[model samples]
Target: MSNLPPQHASEGLSLADQVAHELREDIIGGRLLSGMALVEADLVNRYNASRNTVREALHQLGREGLATYVRNKGVMVRRLGVAEVRDLFLVRRTLEIQAILGSKPLREYQSDRMLDAIEAAELARDREDWQAFGTHSLRFHQHIVGLLRSPLLDAFFTNIAAQMRLVFAVAPDEENFQRPWLERDHEIHDLLAAGHRQAAAEGMNRYLDDSEHALLDLLSHPTRA
Candidate 1:
């Protein structure tokens, strides 16, 4: 069982949301493996939350594709198949490329966030903090998507980012899985900073293609976690 950080009863977030947040962290952090059953009773005990809260949290996770409910089997952490992985990358590539192509000339705030993400990622890599590196990498792409100022798009990417974490968790070598992308992320940032919008978009497309290939390769060959 995962030990969640304590939340005060008076905290502003709803009980369900609080439970969901903790569960999401466990799922992303790999404490809860893919396809593991999420028993409502277990969660209620683990979180000291009401049955209703646990149920609602499961529903929210289902909505995010982090968990799925089967009529007879109840809920379990989601397992992505090869086709799902392919489709995810397809949608991600399209959305990201559009964000890149549509990005305006370097607004200082946006550029700073992008550059900060890159720098943080480098630091995380140096420390061999794969989880932090992954977070920063997602932040880097998120800032790119943020350029469009579309809340809807931003939310979509956020959901995809969560799913991507599950993929990374099952990958063979965490460090190797994430290592190559650090430089690629910097390249994309540099291209955009230099005001080469088209070039940046193209670079993003190639980056996504390479990422998809690597992820698919890992998915096709399961490694014992």
Candidate 2:
């Protein structure tokens, strides 16, 4: 993986936010494996941040569902069990389906952004940049949710998508897992562009269903990295 850009105090972000952003990227990029311990002392040493900053960053990750604070275990990158995986996908399916079915007609700008996101993902895939591919893939879906123009829903989906990355990090054959979805993403976008709202919603439903099964299958019979 490439080196993370250095965080500067002059950047206007809080120290905690900077720390959290770096650690979050590590988790999503699979640099920090699931269930790996996140020790405050270790983090402080690594980031050269204060203990309070590390603590706050860890709390932020907890809120994003990227980490969990166990009673005596402190913080660890969350490892979702089979049931939790299914439950997360269940809520994801519901939210995405609602967004697709109830969203306003696609504004031209929204369409353009969606297409850009897909194209970016394709480019990333061509370069075997799985991290960028995953990032843009989420952005593509985020643009679909953006159709609702609801800030609350956008924030909610963003949080869920972060958790989804945990699952993506653990899946075997990450390239194969992400490849098929590129076509489905294109099909969904095409349906929306054609003004076939119901068809697009149905297409999203199928896409989510297939994704849920694939992830669940991986959880059931995981391949160790």
Candidate 3:
């Protein structure tokens, strides 16, 4: 399969929406790095769309808080700061743990998604693809949010995931940065799958706490991180 995201192929989306959606996916997928310039000319060529369409697309991203306009610098992927990391985790804990705690007794399909993410991470680890491992780990949490069955929160979490990836990228030691939590992802999934949701919720809270602390530490010292 091609590594490129689909361009202008989905039904019912307008030209500008096509570009915005693709860029949004690129951001969440980490193909577009935080603070990377979103040049109008380059985007026009890349998406095979008009310059106006690209501008509109970028406007949409800016509205979504995934990108921002800077003085003399034009638009770029939004660079999250230390404070944003803290707030992101606060939301993560709220939505993620609540999903686990709120979903009474749990269900196979929900747990299945978490299990699939775990297996994907293991595959990435076996291949020594640390970046893919990080992506899969995020997928695990995305599945956790899925247990809530709220489309609105699911959509909001997509933007949060993009910001979260930017925070993770700040840590140069990516393997050591993400490895500890990979185990936790598996552990929580096991607890949820086995219907031990209270245990799973507790583990999730601690996991987010530790994860947030580590991220803030990384942001504070990116060079050494």
- Expressed as tens digits, the lDDT of each residue in 4-118 for candidate 3 is 3454454556888878877877766778888799999988788778899989999988987789999999999888898788889989999999999988666778777888889
RMSD of each: 3.7, 3.7, 2.4
Which residue runs of candidate 2 sit more than 4 Å off their true CA positions? 1-22, 25-32, 45-49, 70-74
Which scores greater on lDDT, model 1 or model 2?
Answer: 1
Residue-level error in angstroms, candidate 2, position 171: 1.8
lDDT of 3: 0.83
> Lowest summed lDDT over 10 consecutive residues: which window, candidate 3?
1-10
Could you tell me every candidate's TM-score relative to the true structure?
0.83, 0.82, 0.91
Candidate order by lDDT, decreasing, is 3, 1, 2
Off by over 4 Å in 1: 1-14, 25-33, 36-42, 45-48, 70-74, 223-225
Candidate 3 or 2, higher TM-score:
3
Candidate 3 residue runs with Cα over 4 Å from true position: 1-11
Model 1 weakest 10-residue run by lDDT: 1-10
Using lDDT as the measure, name the better of candidate 1 and candidate 3. 3
